[model samples]
Target chain A: MPAQTIVPVEANLINALEDRGLRKTSARSAVTTRIETASGAFTAEQLCRDLPEVGRATVYRTIRHLVDAGALCKLPMLDGAPKYSVARNEHHHHTICSRCGAVEEFRHSTVERVMRSLEKEIDGDIVGHRMEIFITCSNCLAESNRGGSSGR
Target chain B: MPAQTIVPVEANLINALEDRGLRKTSARSAVTTRIETASGAFTAEQLCRDLPEVGRATVYRTIRHLVDAGALCKLPMLDGAPKYSVARNEHHHHTICSRCGAVEEFRHSTVERVMRSLEKEIDGDIVGHRMEIFITCSNCLAESNRGGSSGR
Candidate 1:
């Protein structure tokens, strides 16, 4: 199994803030610690709901700062608001379960090869890409097969 | 050059509406026609702006109906609102220029093969996928090469 790693967000966020001449407020510290400990992608609203002590505006502001400081990457979610994940060194894509809202990170050599080929074929300077595969997890499939009602 | 095909929206929308038992209103007809004739993906706000005669609510409602009926597909746009395009029979993906707002459609057998392989690796029933490549188009590249300021 691929090792699922948590980003060193607290240190990074503190360094980023100091480098940008921003103050190390308690709110920023709290938000960064929460984000650092989060296992998967999340939305700003989710952070607010989970961390009731953190103000909504503070969560939004800290999120923006983290994104701008390259500590987080915003991902587009279908049929809902966008989500944010820790910025990692390696390039990877996500396979999301439509039924259970589970996201699995994946990387493949073929994907990189195809992207390079497309860059040449289209004669464009490729900057970035987003690939999301929507799937029904095996658990969800099993439940549905057993005549259980499936929910999105 | 690859053929840029226009989906026959009029016939498809009419059939889709009838199958769903939805009314064939003039507003729906007008929006469908506009979308069919459109050369690229567009947002609902753009439709309302362009077709001032069409009420905003009507445009939104028609868009919802068409999407539910499978006559249109919603595409996620980075840094902007989601866009809608006419649904076609064939599976294809898009490459968009971040600088110039240009879009190019592409298809490859390798992408399908990769998705199928991942379905087993992740042990999920893959249902759908979204792939969007962000690029700097040749025109934008050329302009930037010439030391011209590029706009988003």
Candidate 2:
């Protein structure tokens, strides 16, 4: 797949921090850069490993800041470990490969409409949503077929 | 809210175990019973805390067994700790309160229809799907209103 153009959301993230009266620290800037340049979802541990100079506490704090600012979205893995991705301004959902752990983003107007209708039905102000569909990717399916019943 | 009618799916759980040629151990029976009687989602730690008689290892193993057998569905909590609930035969989704930690289950045929359509669009078999909406519960909203700007 071609590289997804990173829509430089770092400026927006920095402004959000400033709005909350937070100082623009170097650690926060580094974390935002990493999040922006990331190809896909990443974990805090991965961030720490990749940026050894950034202390674990700083990484976590920056992550919390970004998440609170709505600049990052958390995607929960099957094993309960959450992966963080850039929170695009536009709403979308994820389709994850159960076997290969690849995530693809998609949006549907119908789902959005249904969610709006559900807010009235449930009598609560819907703040956020998470939707993920798990499937075996085509490559994994092909390999399983080739291996017959022995393949999982 | 009125208590949700506990559908007795324990029998199906046991049958699933039997189908896998697993023995009907007392530990499994206890875990199944606890799950059947649960009012909502529970974590493995909670289960171990509630059922001290069941060893921690036994609790984890039984949870894995039930999950593999499709007798339980693991819901990912916002904090990354997963909570397991009895997996009913039919499909459903949950709406969770971000403030008070309340969970509400709901089903919509429109959502189901869209999922089926998505499978064709993606050109992949949809094995499973998860949908969760995060909102502030009515009581929390009321409390926030009563406390004015001081309320979180």
Candidate 3:
């Protein structure tokens, strides 16, 4: 497996607050930290649950600010509400693990080429595109192969 | 340009209700007719507005039932709530017009080929995927080219 290059969107919460012209507050600081260090995509409700010390309103506001600041990426799910993840500066797509809820970023030249090629055929001026793939991650696949049905 | 083919998910509301074992209420009939004849994607609120005689609760419940019955397709937007379109039996992707808010369905084999190819490289068992392209539709593009900046 290739090494996953996880890049931090913001080095610290303070710089992000300054960039967005948002006031520095303890509640915002805690929420920013939690978001930056999140291992996978999460919902605002999950963040509220994780940070009982911070007011729910504060957490939601900080999340909105970060999203507007382009520090977080919001993914649209097929069934329920959207999820947010720490944003990466580079262009890429997401692969979500159905079993363990892991999100991985990937980019392939062929996929991009196909997207760009659509410009000539499609009846529109293509401004942007989003693609999300749902999968059972390799870890889960391996576990299933080994007769482990716990996660299922 | 190739002609777009849209096959209906259910021939009629009565059949759809029958398949789901849902009682064919008058309110459900009204909502189902409105949905089946809709020209584009719409929200539950839009349906409620269109069907002023039907109760809001009935419209919402009917939409949920149709979605579950595979009669409507729910599309997730980037920054706002998701919208629903009449379901087409065939597999396809959506191209949304940013200027006019029109949603068009299309299918490209090369795009599907690229998606399937990802399974060999990615660390996951591919289950499903979604792709939504944002564009200025041909009509919008033509209007823009004609020095009509009204939509802008």
Candidate 4:
């Protein structure tokens, strides 16, 4: 099983700030703390609301900073606002459970191989890619199999 | 090779408008013409700028309506505004050339098979997914092979 664990987002923030030759102020710390403990995908608006002490500009800037630093990932939704999540792995994709809002990190060799083969067919150099698989998670599947009602 | 072609955006708009019990107004027709003639991908702001006679609200609303109707697809960019493109095919993913901004629609069985297998591993039912591959198009590859500079 590929390791499915959250990265040390605070450490990533500190490292990113250091790389940019910046200091970690109290506001940054507060935002990092909130993000570290976030349950699943969140939004900048939610962060701004939760971190009232931090300036809205600071919140947005900090999120953008971390995202640029590869510390955060955005989950693109088809019909709604995009959501943000901590980068779980250096080279992994997401399997998001639509039913329970659970996001799982996964890495598979088969997928990577398929991506590499595109170089030949497209006759181009493959630079980067993004994939998001939406599903009903395992737990949700089990619950539905048992015909139990979910609070969600 | 799978069919790599643009969908009939105007027909799609007409059908969508009909489904909503709406008529094909001149404004809608103008927007459709612009979209149909768009090279690869476009933005709402660009469309609004090009069609000054169309209300900004109408431009935004029509784009949303057609997007919901599966006439247009949004190319989610990593560092900039998401670009809009005509949906080229049904049940196909995109390969965007970073060099020339060319978008190619492709459907590969291996990719689909891998996605389906996720059902067993994730213990969930797969609902939907989106994949966008960034690459250099075949033409760009040839140009680069000849050591020629691209205008882009």
TM-scores, each model vs. reference: 0.83, 0.78, 0.84, 0.81
Model with the higher lDDT, candidate 1 or 3: 3
lDDT of each: 0.79, 0.80, 0.81, 0.79
lDDT over C-alpha atoms for residue B10 of model 1: 55
> Model 2 over residues A1-152: C-alpha lDDT tens digits?
55576545456766677778899888877877776776777888999998888999999988888888877777878784688877775678887888767667778787888887787777578998889988887877887889987665
lDDT of 4 at A24: 81
Model 4: colliding residue pairs: none
Give per-residue CA lDDT, model 3, range A9-113, as digits (tens): 446555667687777878887888887776778988999999999999988888788877777778877667678887664568899987777888888888789
What are the per-residue Cα lDDT tens digits for candidate 4 across B45-96?
A: 8899999999999999888888877878877665455778877678888988
**Candidate 4 ranges beyond 4 A from true positions:** A1-12, A138-152, B1-12, B138-152
- CA displacement after TM-score superposition, residue A138 of candidate 2 (Å): 7.2
Q: Considering the two chains of model 3, state its CAPRI-style docking category.
A: medium
Candidate 1 wrongly placed segments (more than 4 Å): A1-21, A138-147, A150-152, B1-15, B142-147, B150-152
Assess the local accuracy of residue A5 in candidate 2 as a C-alpha lDDT between 0 and 100.
61
- Mind listing the fnat for each candidate? 0.88, 0.78, 0.97, 0.84
Give residue B73's error in model 3 in angstroms.
0.9
The residue-by-residue lDDT of candidate 1 on B33-152, one tens digit each, is 787777777889999988888999999988888888777777776567888877675688887888877776777777888887776677778889989888888988888878756433
Instruction: Report the poorest 10 consecutive residues by lDDT, candidate 4 chain B.
Output: B1-10
Clashing pairs in 1: none
**What DockQ results do all the predictions give, each relative to the true complex?**
0.65, 0.59, 0.75, 0.58
Best by TM-score: 3
Residue B102 lDDT, candidate 3, scale 0-100:
89
- Per-residue error for A20 in candidate 3, Å, reads 3.4
